[model samples]
Target: MATQHPNALTRALAELPGPLPAFGVIHIAIPHTSRFTVVGNHLAQHAELSLVAIGIGVHIQSLPVGSLVGIKALTARFAEGEMRIAAALRELEAHGYLRRAHVRLANGRMATRTVFCNQPGALERAGRVVVAPKVPPAVPEEAPAVPEEPPAPPPAPEPDPVPESHPPVRVPPRTAPKPPRRPLPQPRELTPELRRTASAILADLRSHAKELVLSEDDIEELIPGVAAWLEREVRPDAIRHALTADLPKPPKYPAKIVRHRLTVLLPPPLPGAEELAPAAHRPLVIPLQNCDGCDRAFRSREPGRCRGCRDLAAAA
Candidate 1:
């Protein structure tokens, strides 16, 4: 026994007996540079055809080898050896369906190739021309607007929650503290030298009141004697030697022996002699170098002798 041959509604559709319905599919293989018109002419002359998907640079997932695809009047280029849109038509072809081809052309220029196919149906399987089923006109439906819930039923009248409890507490008021006081200190006493200078200044102010008032300056000059006294006190021996050296002659008295001679040279107060005692006394010996009767500290005719001593020596 021989195996049965497959029915081809798809193959018969590829070779249409008349003009194509407004919509159909096509599948075919085309040369690289062949225009869409060649493919479309082959379709119009042979296969039934209609609408297809369209866009420039559109991409398809799978295809039969050497088949051209059409999107609307545009003939999509085949992927060379791969068939496009065939994956979508595989099951239909398996069940003995027919396919149609159409080529797109405009202004005598080829645009794209197309393929047409029939959906499986009782009329198609029975091998007779059947008109496509007409779709019923669509009816518009109006929806009723729903009323919003009445403000959520006034929040369900919630009861007041119980109050919280805690123990009572107290805080004391604060007061500012005062600063401690420091005692005032006493003044220091003035020194003796400072007191003396202050007294002298006061005396000057009193005495020179008019002058100070006139010029606001109190200038007090040192007395000449005070300066001399200071010089003498500071250099007593120098002053004494200078005075003695400048005198015309040396004194007859030995400064140390004169005091001792004073008593002997004077007599006690006598009745009548008291008045004459001072004058009657041997004229106190004033030492001279001329007088030899006394130490030779003074110059006189009689060395170391006074005037009286010289007279006594002459009488001798």
Candidate 2:
């Protein structure tokens, strides 16, 4: 018998099937004309950097200068939580992709300054960049009696050029303070029974979904909506499923999500007994009876002979 064909080599030589999903990712890349960030394979293919870290670095680079990459800002924007984001930042810092320093401002408040280094290896060898030159102190003027050599003009020490990879660091200007988040409003006028049942269900939601752990205040705000579902005879388990199912990865606004689900997925109230249509009356089924003269079976409302048997008897 002939030897089996080489499957791997054949598949490799053949054109990739259009309809089929082949192994590995295929790129039909369009060259970017603008708004593009250049990333080196050193960073892109770092052996030690985690996927999260690589993503964060790229995101930071693509952002406009002075765009906030703080923990809170990142958590709100990306699916990764604060802890993971923080860890990724630290990873980038350790790998020389980023540097963070705490500096106290003129207003006596501390601020974190983050610097993105495109090529960390070059920056390390070149050392820190100097923004301004250090001027030598002027020589003290002596009296005419001891007029020795005239003092020379101070030599201006030229500052070192910024490393090829490290750009000039610029701090963002101070702006007006932001307003605090508005408080959530709790529902009122719900009956004790309904409120209790709905609250219980909401409170227990954390068990099924770790990300859905809502604050007590948020639960209070969302009670009315869940109670509405309960009024419509929706089961507690079903209510749980609707609120938690297919939720976005690492849901940031748990309260808003719960409130939205409760409002949108609420079932219509069941109709009352009187509102339901009465059962339709079915026609009575006749029983099979034997004919008196012919002993033939026939269907009749009451026990009687078949029509043929009755006609024969009449004739006789």
Candidate 3:
């Protein structure tokens, strides 16, 4: 069986509507140099925009204004939170790359218009294009003129009295005695040395942890504890060991940790007389002067030595 061709079998074909005119394509021109300009401009630093901010700016330039789906689209595309998108938009506006104006429409409608610019000067140009409503001139009313009064005549001159001369007395001028200058207080004997030690320790810790950032004030405050520990005959290595022990990985608040350890590990004060007194009659003893070695107040029969110094000397 020979099948007849469908085109040969058809008697007539209805004409199809002429192909609809192809919709016009929208082409947006973005300069490649914009990337260099955006990063090199002072606005980038002033606005403190991260890579997220740059992404948001590029999208804003490409997308249509007042797009309700922009937030969701940006979130999906950039893998960022809505708040971050909003913040980036704010940064762009702050740096003059974006502007929003509330405009009243011809039909008494209000709309928010978003304007994006590649350069800051475009914002000024956009602003100038908006013509302000002309204000009518006000005709000021004339004030009544005030009459001027004539000047009064000068008074008559009085007669001068005869001059009386007296011998000028020679008096010595009193002079104030200059105040004595008080000597400036000298720096503490241990402060400079302890400060140097503190600086070295802080530098070492920063190198090791990279997170331990201490200011000069923090170092100054911490040095006193270090000095106290040194005065108590504790070795610097011991202090370092104590600080570094049991530290968390990438320790948080290193200054706080150091301070806590320094305070908690401080040696207890030397035993008082109450501890040395006999069980039968415990008498109260008052410390007379500070120890020469550690500057700790203690009751001692000797002139210069505290009990700790005496013990150290005996051990030596």
TM-score winner among the candidates?
Answer: 2
Runs of candidate 1 exceeding 4 Å displacement: 1-81, 96-119, 130-133, 136-316
TM-scores of the models, in the order given: 0.14, 0.34, 0.25
Better of 1 and 2 by TM-score: 2
The TM-score of candidate 2 is 0.34
Give the winner by lDDT: 2 or 3: 2
Judge candidate 3 at residue 219 and give its lDDT: 72
Q: How far does residue 297 in candidate 3 sit from its true spot (Å)?
A: 99
Estimate the overall C-alpha local distance difference test score of candidate 3.
0.56
* Residues 1-316, model 1: lDDT tens digits: 8997655865655564344445434323222222111111222222232212211111221222233333321233533222334432442334323334232333222343222222235435654322221211222122223243111111223333221212111111123333332221111444454334433432343243222211212112211211232222323333223323322234333321222222222222235545557775746555446445654356444435666776888999
lDDT of predicted model 2: 0.70
Each candidate: how many clashes? 51, 0, 0
Q: Which one is best on lDDT? A: 2
Model 3 regions lying over 4 Å from their true place: 1-47, 64-70, 129-316
Return the candidate ranking by lDDT, descending.
Answer: 2, 3, 1
Better of 2 and 3 by TM-score: 2
What Cα-based lDDT does every candidate model obtain? Answer: 0.31, 0.70, 0.56
